[model samples]
Target: MRLEGVFARYGRRDAWVLQNVDGEVRQGDTIVITGRNGAGKSTLLRVLAGLLPVGRGKVRDRPDIVGWVPERFPTAQPFAVLAYLQGIARVQGLSQSLAQKTIDAWGERFFLTPFFATPLEELSKGTARKVGLIQALLNPPQLLVMDEPWEGLDAQSQAELPAVVEELTKNGGSCVLTDHRGRAADLGDVRHWQVHQGVLKEEDAPAPQEDAEHHVIEIVVRTDEVGTTVEWLREAGYDVHGTRERR
Candidate 1:
């Protein structure tokens, strides 16, 4: 999808949230939107998700299968967690049986199984956010837009999200996410966009120093999941050398 000369605002009385914003969302791209508070990062995501209409210019070729996880899930509704997600699946064109199956799988994966029967209003903020995240993945979408998706998630859920997003991009899906906490771990080849004064521009991240002096410190882990530890190190940009043995 491409946005050209786009402009947006919440209301007529409000100032423009995005001004002449021109950008592109390509397959296999993970775009991270960043800015200060009230900098219109969420507004940009909504515009990309097609929830907000452009006041000027145009957005072209937005994916038909779009999944959006909002910053806030409306937990004031009266419905069970599973029911809400199944309803979302149905809206996404899944059959009842398939919706149930998908919901069950994501519920287990996201640790939401224990709250399947819990009412929306009764669930905590973090748990409700899990449901929101699961709903977005009920069916793999061509364009996945997320606004502060990791805000209320637990540590395990936060760690799992990067892998899930990596899988999506591997399958040629595109993502646009807004993160205030800067906690988003290594999503490969990510393009960072920053919003300031209603203008968006790509942030130039500093390249890693290749010739910097380094020291090696071996960590002797007792568990059998050494590969997992090594993978984490590599993702954190370490030059790992040991691959002949697993312990």
Candidate 2:
């Protein structure tokens, strides 16, 4: 998909949230969008998802499928979480039983199985975000757009996001995501773009050092013997690194 001179405005004003934004994303690519607040990061993602109309220029795509997950998950529905995910699955053209099965599987992966019957309005913020993310990935779209997918997630859930991105890209899917935390390092070889003043620019930074050498050492000491261990090591004329004692 590509956007050429794209511009968008929320109201009748010449000030566009996105102005003259031009970019291209090929299949199996993961592009990370970064910017400060109100830099039109989310606006650009919505435009790419076709949720917002572009006021000027054009967005061209020949996608076989598309999926989107906003920064904020909608949790005002009266239906159960599983039922809501099932609805999304149906929209993706899955059979009823298939949809339920897929939802169940994702629930287990995201640790949301306990909340299957819970109402959408009753879940915590992180859990709701998980539901939104799973809905987008249940059927695997050709294009996936996510906004702040790591927000409000616990340590475990945060660790799982990179794996999900890996699976999508492995299947020839593409992704455009905006995040403030800049934690996409685990995605591996991602193309980084910065949105500034309603424009997107590619950042040219030096490549990471791949052949750097590193070392690791482990030691075990008896309880309350940490000071003695450090003193003995120092007396032996060995270079001692830092030390820590865990209760």
Clashes of each: 0, 0
Q: Which stretches of candidate 1 lie over 4 Å from their true place?
A: 206-247
lDDT of model 1 at position 67: 87
Q: Model 2 reaches what TM-score against the true structure?
A: 0.81
Candidate 2 backbone clash number:
0
lDDT of 2 by residue, 120-173 (tens): 998767778889889888887898999988776655677898998898889999
Q: Candidate 1: minimum summed lDDT over ten consecutive residues — where?
A: 231-240
Per-residue alpha-carbon lDDT of candidate 1 for residues 26-46, written as tens digits (9 for 90 to 100):
999999998888888999999
TM per prediction: 0.82, 0.81
> Which ten contiguous residues of candidate 2 have the minimum total lDDT?
231-240
Q: Global lDDT for candidate 2?
A: 0.82
TM-score of 1: 0.82
